[model samples]
Structure formats: structure tokens, C-alpha cells
Target: MTHTFRPRIAASIAAVAVLGLLAGCTGGTAEETTEQTVTFWTPQATPERLAAQEDIAAAFTEETGIEVEVVAMAGADQDQALVTGAASGDVPDVILHASTQTGAWTSQGLLDTEAAAAVVDTLGQETFNEHAIEAVTLDDQISAVPSDGWTHVIAYRTDLLEQAGVEVPTSVTELAEVATTIKSELGITGLAFGTQAGTASATEGIQSIFQAAGCDLVVDGEVTIDSAECTEAAELFLTLRNSSVAGDFDVTSARAAYMNGDAAMLLFSTHILDELAGLDEATPATCAECVDSPTFLADNTQFVTVLDEENPAQYGAILSYGIPTGANVEGAQQYIEYVMSNGYVDTLGVATEGRIPLRNGMADNPTEFIDAWGALGIGPAHERTSVDLYGEEFVGGMAEGINAVYLWGMGTDDATLAGLVASQGVLAGQIEQLYNGAAAEDVTSAMKAAVEEVQASL
Candidate 1:
């Protein structure tokens, strides 16, 4: 993956010259005379991940004769880059990004909804995760092609819970009680989750609680963050945070607390699966017992995929491929189709822990990709499949959960507004206010006002 930005101006100028020559000689379309090249911007920029993407691109090129230039872009910098590219008409042919940006990008006229929908149709919509596809849909059109997604999980130490005589939590109240008991009996942090404001972890952590409690941020283009359910959700989130380690915990610190044996339960994405299993050397398990058994934590951990028995929802984030407005539509579609089909398993194998396959399989074998994904190895060092670490039942449950995962503004008329609200961290900031001892009503009021402000701006 190359970080060096290549302006599309040069390519456009050269393409025009080539078209002129082709018109003068053969009077044929550019597609008939010249090979196509698709520019792909991806945020998965680590060396290992980039190499995997390059290999996938190479394979696609071999099969389709369409060249792909894989560019490495940081996820944080992608928004500004997209804005700049859209303004200059120099955007990449296709972009791999979070589903939260789909509505906003489409509303700004940056993405080509028709092109994305065409790819979805070509690949067979029935093969992809319905919830993921729904998230990227706006105005009855697919804004992007859903790629992969991971759900936030409630991971508890089975040994610690059994020793404390507590059952796994299934509801908000029970979860809080379990955390409290663990803290009192084990003398360890009861729970670990992100509390830092304006971070992805905090935003996602609170949003999961809200979704599980049936709280709505936007409904029919109206700001509905000040409702009773949202207030209750906020209070519940605060209760969990209060039981966590002292001070603010971002994603990294929270994971560390749990892996270091300082916390008994963790609220994080499935990305932690690799680290918890001692498969990633950089973030290896360091629990006291892990010194003797590297996978001690992995063996003793149990994940709660869905909480809040009444509502029954799980928080998840989906990644998608969005073709830009002025891109090589045909070539981009070809590349996406290839990756989602023939190259699907290898592409997802780059980081199996985080990249849950959104596309299950081909139309003929709808469960192929899902089954293969369960067998794909995870972690950077000494890889092992989730099926090997956890059982097939556990892995299958995770696959099923992805189809019903929840996100705040998805599947609503005001999805664009919801995207803007999420991108701006409106609710995340409100979570911080709760952490600072502000009343839940006041926090909800502030959140409602902030969302209204964003809606008004739009």
C-alpha cells in the first residue's frame, strides 16, 4: 500500500489524449482499445494487511485484466481526503470505509449509488448480511457494497464469574449487579469499556447500550435523543463505567486492563479475540496464569453476544466499498465482484478477527463464505481459527449475530442526518457528560439539541 497521493488530474489528461488518438484511428471506445485501471483507497494500511490486499488485487488483475492500484490511507484522514478529492474531482475509483460514512458521502454527491447497487445485484444481494446491506441503503438504493463487520461483545472471565457465584448477564440490571459482585469479591476492576470522549470506542460503547435499550437517536428525520429510553440507556452506561477501572479508558487502555488481569469483564469488539488468545505478539495475553499457559484467558473466557433480553440486539459496525461519482464504474465493479467472490476468503483472511464476512457465499452456496470465514486463521503471530480456539457453536452464533446487529441511524428516513450526528460525535460527547456527573436528563437534552443543530446544518 502506498501512502503517496497520486492526483487523478494526470491520469484524466492522459486518458483524454488516448481517447483522441483512438477516435482518430479506430473510432472505438476507450474501453475497447485500452486496459482499465481502478484506484482503490483502503484504511487497512498495516504492512501485513496491505500485502494481503495487494495479493488480492494481483489475483483480480490476473482474472479480469483490470489493473488495481491499492493506496494506503489512514481511517482518520479518509474523510478530509474524500472531501478534498470530491471537490477536485480526483477521488479514487472505489473506497473501502465504515458504513457510518455511507449516507453522508452519498448526500454530498461523492458516491455512485447506481454503480454500488449494480455490484450488489451482480454479486447476488441474498449472499450478503441483510443488516449490513440495510445500513448502506438510502432512498431505496444501495449506497455502497457491504464488505465485512464485527459486533461489540461482552466478554467475561468464566473462572472469575464461577468463583464469585454469578451467572452470565442477560439484561442491563443483571449486568450491573454482576460487575458489582465481581469487583467486591475478586478485588479487580468489575468491567472495562471506553469512557474517553470523541473516540470511536466511547461512541460505539454508548451506542451499543442505547441500541440494546431500544433508544432511538433519529426517527423519521426527527431528533429523538431525549426520550425516556435514551435517558435510561445513559444511566445504565454510566453505571457500567463507574464499575470500570478508575480514570478514563480509551480502547487501548480498556483492552489492556482486561488482558492484564486487572478487569474481570470487557466490553469491546471481536477484534480483541486475537489478542485474548495470545496469538498477536504485540498485544499478547499477560494474565497471571498466562505466564504458564499462553491461551489461559482464551480458554476461560465466554462472550455474551446479545444482552438486554427484552430488546435483544447487538452493536456492530460494517465496512463497505463505495465507488466514487466519477470513477471507472465498470472496472470498479469488476474489482469488487472479484474480491467478494473468488478472493473473498483471502481478502477477509487479512484480519479475520475484525473482518467478519458480510457476504455469506455465492447464490448457489449461500453459506460457503460464512463457513470458510469460521475456518480462516486469526492473529499476526502463529494464527489459529476462531473454530479452533472457541467451538463451532460459538463461531456460528457470531455469524448469525452479524445479520441482526444494530447501529443508531441505519434503516431510517433520516440516515444521512444520523451519519452526520455519529461522525460529529454528538452522542459520544453526551456520554462524557454523564461520566462527569451531569444529570441524565440534561445529557439527553444536550444530545437532542446537538443533533438538531446537525440536522439544521444539513
Candidate 2:
């Protein structure tokens, strides 16, 4: 598969939110120029996203005779390059950026939204999930199509759970009880949390715990993390964090534990399954000793997951192809149009890690992508947990609120806990701040201010 957009490479990044993006609309794009090559930019293409990228690019070349130069940029630095490109008039024909900064990016005119409207009709209102669109939706206009995404789940060692005679909980309370029991009875720490709670692993993956708590980030266009509802969630988060079998979220460390069969439960994304597959057979046996599970949704509450979500929420992202606002508009649009079509996306279904084929019935039966990441049985995956978030509130609450839950559980008082939660937000920007020596205090204070902003807006 060849990418029409510039070539892609996963560049170094502290964290480039892969899913859960909110898109925006801008002035309509221009028509493709007479003859030319289109440039596309993307992070190091993962198997799934890469497969889809190449499928569309190859199709475009075959049909339109346009050659695309794909660029492999680091996830962390893609934004800097993208922003630079947009500013200098050197942006790619299409870009696949993380959804986390989508809102801010759109607000800043970094991306064009009007083009999204041109294709929304063909994409179908139902083509992508609702929240996926909502995240990128601004002022009644959609910026990007909610493409494929992932979700967080409580991956557990099923064999271990059975041996310990402890069943995974469907509810938050049960989840806690199980964690506590695993520790008390077998002297085994039950859950494995990242170094800090709500980091990338938790934010993109385990953050679902908060979602299952019946607390959504946004509710009726209001931010609600500081409210009593999120307070409870905060407490629960702290409790889970303090009780994890391990207290580190470093991907390398977690994988080692998973392979060693030392950790039973992990807050991680569905994609890990594929990553595990790529590992040595001996390494994956530990995961087989375990299984992926989620906080089963209860009978109550309609799920409103984050965009760019890692499952149940299906947070959408754009594996988009774009041309510079004033450059390659036509070519970019044509490239994107071709990729979005059923024919090309359809080809993605069988390319390596077969795509889920976001287009309707295209990948009719679950493809490798769907089989791996689909939220088909989310309700029955793990026990449900109590959540206190809803709607607009979850936005700011996600980064901080989740961390507060972890800190409070770890024994911090209200004031101290609040500061800790605030840190997670700024800490999230660690990747971007990489060039400069980290100023933890300054960053934390800024995060504190941001949290206050969210609270005031709420």
C-alpha cells in the first residue's frame, strides 16, 4: 500500500494523542491543480493506520496518476511540523494528526474545516459514531471524519483471576473490591497502573474507568470535573492507582510485566493485543496467561466516549489527506475523496492488520482490525464502575480528574490532591516541552490555572 499524502514515520514524541479528536471546519478547499505530486504527512504509521494509509494512496495513484510522497514524522513532533507547514505554506496535501489537540488546532485555523462539509454528505451522518464527530464538531460544522480509533480496557490475566478465585468487576465498586481482594488474599497486587495515573496509557486506555463511572467529560456543553460527581471519580481513581499491582505505566515496563506473567490486570488499550502478537512467542504467553477486559457498562447511562478513543467510545481521528489551504487544494481534496470512498477503505480491510473499514458494511464481517479493537462485547467485558462525569465536564476532567482519583487514593489531602491532578494536564504536554529542560513547577502552575479555567467555565 502506498500513501498519497507524504510518507510517514512515527517520530519521537512525549505523547501524541492517537485518538479521541474533535474536528472543526474552515473555508472550503480549492480544486486540484492541473498536474502534480501531492505531499502527505503522518506519524510513523502503525500497522492499521499505515495499512489504511497505503491502500488509499495506491488507489489514488492507480486511478488518478498522482504520485504521493509520504513522510514519516514523529508523533511528538508532527504537530510542530504541521503548525510550521501551515504557517509557512508548506503543509502536506493530507495530514493525520492526533485528536487531542484537534480542538485547539481548529480554533487556531491550523486546519481547514469547510472541506469536511463538502464530503460529509458522502461520508454519511451515520458513517462515523456521534461523539467522534462531536469532538471535532465546532459551531455546527464538522472538521474531520471520525476514522478508526481504539479504547481502554482492564486487561487481566484470566487464568490468574480464576486461580485467585476473584472475578473482574463490572462496576467501579466491584473493580476496587477485586483489586483489594487480589492483594489481601493472594499477596498479589491486582491492577497495574502506569508510573503516574492517567498518563498516555491511562488517558487513552484506562481512562474508561472514569467513563464507566457514569461520568462523561462533557455534558450539555459544560465542563464538570471539579463538581462533586468528579470528586467521587477522583477518589475512585486514587484508590485504583494506590492499589495497582505495579505503580508504573512505562510501556516497556508494562510489557515486560505482561510477558513475565507478573502482573494480572493492566489498564491499557486494545491495540496492545496486536503489539503483543509482534513480540516473541515466549513473550506473548504471559498475555495469554491473561486476557483483555473492560469495566462493563451497566444498565444505566448512555456511553459518551472521548473522540480519538482507543473502544466503546470510538473516539474518532482522521487518517486525513489534505492539501495546503492555498496550495494543492484540488489535489488534496481528490486524494482525500478517493481515500474516503468505499473502494479504497475496503481494500484496507485485508491489508496486514486488516482495517475495521469505518465505512458502512464495507468490511461487512469483522476484519482483523475489527476483530482486534471492536467494542462488540464491551458491556460484558468487565464489571461496571460508578462514574460521576457527564457531557462537557469530562473535557478538562479527563487529564486532571482521573489523576485526582489516583492521588486521593494514594493518601493526598484535598489541596495536595488538587495540585497533583493539575500536574497531569501540564505533564501531558511533556512531549512538546521536550526541547526545553522541563520546568515542572512552572508547568504545574500553568496546569493549575487551566484547571481553574475549566472550573470557572463549568
For each candidate, give its TM-score against the true structure.
0.88, 0.63
Model 2, residue 430: distance off in Å is 15
* lDDT digits (tens) for residues 1-458 of candidate 2: 11112222323122223321112122232233324566666664555444545555665666777666555565567667667656656666566554444544565676667765566556565654344455456566666544444344455665667777986566666667776777666666666655443355544323345445544443443433445544454455556655656654565666566545566666554334433332223334343323441111111112222322222332213233333354455566666667656343333332222123333322343232222222221111111111221223322323221111211111111222233333354333332231143343343344335555544542
- Highest TM-score against the true fold, candidate: 1
Candidate 2 local distance difference test against the native: 0.44
Can you tell me which runs of candidate 1 are displaced by over 4 Å? 1-34, 86-89, 197-200, 308-312, 436-438
Q: What TM-score number comes out for model 1?
A: 0.88
The C-alpha stretches of model 2 lying farther than 4 A from their native spots are 1-34, 45-56, 195-208, 216-223, 245-249, 275-324, 342-450, 453-458
Query: What are the per-model C-alpha RMSD values against the true structure?
Result: 6.2, 12.2
